[model samples]
Structure formats: structure tokens, C-alpha cells
Target: MIRLATVIDTFEADFLAQYRDQLTPDHYRALAAMKHCRTQASPMMQVKCTACEHQKLVPHSCGHRHCPHCQHHESQQWLERQLKKQVPAEYFLLTFTLPAEFRTLAWAHQNVVYDLLMSCSWETVRTFSQNDKPLQGTPGATAVLHTNTRRLDYHPHVHLVMPAAVVDGKQKQWRTKPRGKAKGGYLFNHKALAKVFRAKILAAIETAGLTLPARYPQEWVVDCKSVGSGESALIYLGRYLYRGVIQENDIVACANGQVSFRYRNAKTTRRERRTVSGAQFLWLVLQHVLPKGFRRARNFGFLHPNCKHVIALLHVLLKCVPGQTLAWVKQRAPILCTCCGAVMAIVRTRIPSPFTGQLPISIAAEGNP
Candidate 1:
């Protein structure tokens, strides 16, 4: 499988050499980070095998949020934290997608449009959950912003993980539909949900001083389905929410100035191959760096940070012991060798020469636990 670093190393120079003046600083920074990730440009550490006494230098990860190499470890860490927040409750997955028209707006004003998509989509769900027949109470939800589709196109959408049963406002208890009522545990009407979400988001766009063509499509897309278990959905969504647009497994080949990848087409329900020049591939991947400090995944209702009291009450509702707990655990680095499958120790860190124009890094000898 072809890694993103390989593609970036192959074509980042040409892409930057040709379009540096046209690209923004953030784009340049993300591309440069990807190109230099886990390379000699980054810091290196010397590791010695505990069993074989083999010593080798390995480059450290750049740890950019958009880097595919760095995000798997981060995503796994996040999944653990998110899993601890889960309650023993049935959950639903709801997706609110932007139409093709809004993708242009999102590209131009990502912060504003993306925030609006998240807020407006949540509001649409919250409002309907309060007023709809099947759902009469508010449901705790965590909305994750996804900027790319299966085809890796600039498709901005929000996926919400919400409780299948709503939490009562007055009673502070979880409630579900009567046993004979909604058969599928659905929250609201799909077409109706789409209409409301579109109207609200369009109004938000107008408020942002952008006007749309009057001839745009009347129907929008809003999907709602029961995920049965909330933890599984959270794990799946966490991976996509924290990672790069395309995975290394999707990459088929990189040679002769072209990169080829595969994507499962939604309409055709079959795998399809797409090949593009290395420069074009790098540019396409860089398009999803996102604005600096934009919080893509956010919790709402009882899960938010400011809702400590509400969270305690929720724990009571779930029969969990009530106490403020640290959920985000520190992630530990691996000691095992990637190549030889042997235990290893960090014997020292390699410091680049000052004359070479690289920043100084610490050198330390540490044994693996």
C-alpha cells in the first residue's frame, strides 16, 4: 500500500514549486509536514533490541492532526476516551449533508459554514426531537464534522451520535417510544427532516451574506438509522473524524508521476479506481487540512464540559457511581519493534547538526518498561 508520505515526497516539490504563490500558508504548512513526516527532516531516536541487541534509528512522527500516519494512534486514544463516556443506551446515527452548492461556500469560509452546518444540524435534530411524535425529549449527541466523502471529494457533512431514547428535561430520566409505537426506533421523517435542515442551513448561509441560485434542488439529504450499540458507532466515526481523507489501504499504486487509489462508489456499489498525477493527488489531499484550531468533533447536551452537574445527574440515571473522573488517559508509546517483532529501548536521540539548519532536540537513553 502506498502511504501519503510517499505521494507527498514524490510531488510536493513540484506542487509547491509551481503554486506556492497561489496557496495559503496553512496549505503549505500541512503539505510540508506531510512530506517531512517520519523522514530525516524530522527528529530521530536510536532504539536497541532487548533480545537481539539490534540498534537502529527511527524517525519520529510529525503529529499533525491531518497526517494519516499520526492519526491512527490519536484516533485509538480518542476512541478509548469516547468509550468511557458511553452509557448503556441504544443510540442512533444521524447524518446531515450539505448539497453541492454549499461545498463552494464551505471551501471559501470553512470556519463559518462548517460551524453553521454543525449548529444548524444539531438544532434541527434537537428541535424535532422535542416536537416530533416519536421523540418528545432531548437526546444527548456528539456531532463530528467530516469534510470528505467516499470519493474524497469536498463534501462537508455532520454525523451525529445520539441516544435512541431521549432524556427527559423535567424528570431527568431516559424515555423511549411505547413498545407498540415506532417499529424501527426512528426519530423523525427523513423527507421532513431534510426540508427543515435545508431551510435552516440556507437561512444561515444568507445570514452569512452569501446568496444561492433560486434554481437549486428543493430536496436535501438527512439520514437517520439505529446503530443498536453506541460504542461501535462512536469507534467507527472517531476513526474517520480524526484521520486524513484517504487511507493507505485505499491507495493502489504510485509510480510514473501518477497515484492510483480505490473508493467504493455509493451509487454503483462497487470498487472503482481513480488515477491522478502526483501533484494533483497531493493538492486533493491537502484540500482537507481544515482551518487552524477548528474543533471538528464536539459533544452536546449532558456530554459537554460545562455540564458537570448534568453529567453527574446522568451518571445517576445510568446507575454509574457519581464522581468527577478523568476520561482522557495519557497514551503510551510502543516498545516493540515494527520490523523484527522484538522488544526495543530508546538508547538515545539523534540531534541534527546546527549547521544543517534544523532545530535542536533532546537526547535521552530510556529503557522500555
Candidate 2:
């Protein structure tokens, strides 16, 4: 498998030369973190074995959210938290996509546009739920912003994984969408959803003081499809939530100034390979680096962190077991002693990197043998 760090190290100079003027601080930061992740240039941790007292210094992960080399623990924790709030109802995955004509505008003002996209999508859904005859109440949703397509193109979209349920705060009631006889079980009219979503987002952009493109698509795209139980949908979204856009294992080869990676084509449902100049590939990946401190995933309505009691009550009333539906997240494997085979525990962390011109203080000097 080709590592992202290897690709970054090889193509960084060319990438910088080609796009230096276009690079943002977030892009530079992501490049640096992914390049040194788990390498000798990164910080180190000292661990000692329980049985044999064998001590070792391990390189620490950079822990950047965009670094594909790390954050497995964080990703799993997020999935677990979402799973804990799962309710026994049919769920739907709703996707709202920005028109191609708006790409340049979104790229120039990402934080504003992205936030508006998410907020507008949620607001559209909330509006629809309140107006629906059966569910005249606010609905809960978990929205995640994705900035790349399967081929790593700069396509910004927001996906909302929402249960078919709504909570009436005033009436103190919970109601689920009546399952329709349609083929996949209906949630809402996709066409109507697209219409409302388009208006809301366009108005939102103008309200935010951004110039609207003179020629934009009259019809935007919004897809709503049923995903049973919602656990699988949450897991799918969680996979790329912390890890970078492209997985390292998907990168098949890098040779002859070109990098090749594979992605499953969404429409064709088949695996396909795309090869591009190393510099171009780097640009494709780095262009997706979100603004510093911007949240890519969020919970709204009842799935929010502040609604634990509400979720807990629903779980009891509906007889839903949160973690029981999905397989338990396995604990991280413990470091083992080569001498005695016992587990090793971290004794110290944040040791200076060798590249920093400071020697890591010996663990033995800290009074441990």
C-alpha cells in the first residue's frame, strides 16, 4: 500500500511551486502533519512493559483530523456516541449538493459557504418536517459536510442521516414517519426537497453578502433514500469523517511523475482507477483541507449532545439497545514486551522529536529501570 506521507514527500516541492499562491494555512498545516505522521520527525512516547520492564520509544502520531495515518480511536468513539443515540425507526440519508457553477464561489469563501450549506440543508428539512401532515414537528438529523467527490474533485455537499421520527416539544410527543408502500419506503418527495433546498441555499448565500453566480442551475440536487436502522449509514459516514478524503490503501501506485488511486464509481458501482500528475494529485487532496477549527460533522435537533435525556427516554420507550445493535468497538491493542510478552503501558509522552535538535530524555533517568 502506498502511504500518503510518501506521496506528499515526493511531490511536495512541485505541488508548492505550482500552487504556492493558492495554498492556505490549513493546506500547509495538513501537508506538514500528514508528511511527518508516525515518522521519526514527529514526537515520541515512552512505554514500559509490565512484566519484563522493557522500555521502548515509539513515534507519536500527528493526530491531525485530515491525517489518514491516525485518528482511528477518535473515529470509533464518534461512531459509538452516535450508535448510543440510535432509535428503532427507519432512517434516510439525505444529500444536498451545490451546483457546479457555484464551485468557484464556494472555494473562495469556504467557511461561510460550507456553514450556510449545512445550515440551509438542515433548515430545509426542519421546515419540511414541520409542514408534513403526519409529522408536524421538528425532526432530528446528523449532518456531515463532504468537500470531495469519489475522484477527489472539489465538490462540496452535505449529507444528513435522519431518522423517520419527529419530536413535538410542545405536545410532548414522538412520531415516526408512516412507512409508505413505495419500493424503498418513502420519506419525502425528492423533487420537492430539491426545490425548497435550492431556494434556501441561494437566499442564504445572498444574505451572507456573497455574490451569486449570474448563471446557476435552476434545479439543485437533493436525494433521500431509506437506510434501514441507520447504524450502517452512520458507520459509512464515520469512516471518512476523521480520516482524509482518500485512504492510503486506495493509492495503488506512484511512478513516472504520476500518482494512481482507485475509487468506486458512484453511478457505475464499479471500482475505477484515476491517474494524474503527482502535483495535480497533491492539489486534489489538499484543496479539501477545511478551515482551521471548522466542524465537518454536527448533530441537530434530538441527536444533539444536549439531548441525551431525550434519546435515553426514546430508547427506553422504543426498546432500542444502543451499542447492542452494532458490534462493540474493539479496544486498541496493547503494546507487548519482546522479552516477556506482557503489555506495555505508556510511561511518558510528548518527548521532543529528534529533528528538533533536542535529545529525548532517557526513561531510565526518570527513576524507572
Best by TM-score: 2
Under the 3 Å rule for N, CA and C atoms, how many clashes does model 2 have?
A: 0
State the lDDT of candidate 2 residue by residue for 1-369, as single tens digits: 999989988888888788878987677777877888888888899999988888999999989898888888898888888888888789999999999999999999999999999999999999999999889998999999999999999999999999989999999999998899887789889999999999998899999999999899788789999999888789889999999898999999999999999999999999999999999999998899999999999999998899999999998888877878658565567888888899999999999876842211222233321
Q: What's the residue-level lDDT of 284 in candidate 2?
A: 91
Off by over 4 Å in 1: 17-22, 46-57, 133-135, 178-184, 267-269, 308-316, 320-333, 337-342, 345-369
* Model 2: worst 10 consecutive residues (lDDT sum): 357-366
Lowest lDDT sum, 10 consecutive residues, model 1, at 360-369
lDDT of 1 by residue, 220-303 (tens): 999988776576678778766666788788989999989898988979989999998888777778788888899999888766
Candidate 2 regions with alpha-carbon error over 4 angstroms = 357-369
Cα displacement (angstroms), candidate 2, residue 82, comes to 0.4
